[model samples]
Target: MTLHGRAADAREASHLAIPVGSPILAGAHRWSDDEGVIEYGEWCLPPRMTIGYEYQP
Candidate 1:
């Protein structure tokens, strides 16, 4: 998984319903099994939104 903060591009801004060059939280992740990647996705959130994750071992 990877996460970053950046200025939203035209496409992202449109989807996020914000103006171009607005700040946004973006991330991409992939899940895999022995054979190959099982799932992959990309997402972005508006500035006011928050996201969290937890891991246990």
Candidate 2:
């Protein structure tokens, strides 16, 4: 998994309901097993939104 902050493009802006070039949080993740990749995805979040994750090991 990887995350970064970048300016929203036109497509991202439209779907996120934010103006183009606005700052946004973007991320992509990949999950794989022995055979091959099981899942992969990319996503963007609005600037004002907050997201968190907790790991227990």
Candidate 3:
């Protein structure tokens, strides 16, 4: 696959992995590179508010 194609595939995979109805905390994490970037944040379930990874892929 080409570089852009690979990036898009990764982005799609990350979107698919997240559970529905989770609340995401903005700016929880960040990443950058010469070609592309991705950010990871935190999300939580209600009541317990268990933290989980939120991906911006």
Candidate 4:
């Protein structure tokens, strides 16, 4: 999924996606501090549950 506009909104959406298909809890983060800066954000899959993405840009 591609999200536009505020990055915070996009980060929120990524968190909501982790539970699809009943995946095991891995780890996630949205590294935004009080400085109002977002450096990185990502989520992980269980060792047995791997996923791939196709990027065309």
TM-scores of the candidates in the order shown:
0.88, 0.92, 0.21, 0.26
Highest-scoring model, lDDT: 2
Stretch of 10 with least lDDT, candidate 3:
1-10
- Tell me which residue pairs clash in candidate 1: none
The number of the candidate with the highest TM-score is 2
Q: How accurate is candidate 1 locally (lDDT)?
A: 0.93
lDDT of 4 by residue, 1-57 (tens): 222222223344366553334434344445567897476554444324556679899
Q: After superposition, how far is residue 4 of candidate 1 from its true place, in Å?
A: 0.6
lDDT per model, in order? 0.93, 0.95, 0.37, 0.44
Off by over 4 Å in 4: 1-22, 47-57
Per-residue lDDT of 1-57 in model 1, one digit per residue for the tens? 898999999999998889999999889999999999999999999898967779899
Q: Residues 1-57, candidate 3: write the lDDT tens digits.
A: 011111223333356454443333222344667866665454222222244467897
RMSD, candidate 3, Å: 12.6
Model 2 regions more than 4 Å off? none
Task: Report the number of clashing residue pairs per model.
Answer: 0, 0, 0, 0
**lDDT, candidate 2, 1-57, per-residue tens:** 999999999999999888999999999999999999999999999988988889899
lDDT of 4 at 9: 36
RMSD of each: 1.1, 0.8, 12.6, 11.9
User: What local lDDT score does residue 13 receive in model 2, on the 0 to 100 scale?
Assistant: 97
Q: What is candidate 2's local distance difference test score?
A: 0.95
Top-down TM-score ranking: 2, 1, 4, 3
Q: Which of 2 and 3 is the better model by TM-score?
A: 2
The deviation in Å at residue 44 for candidate 3 is: 7.3
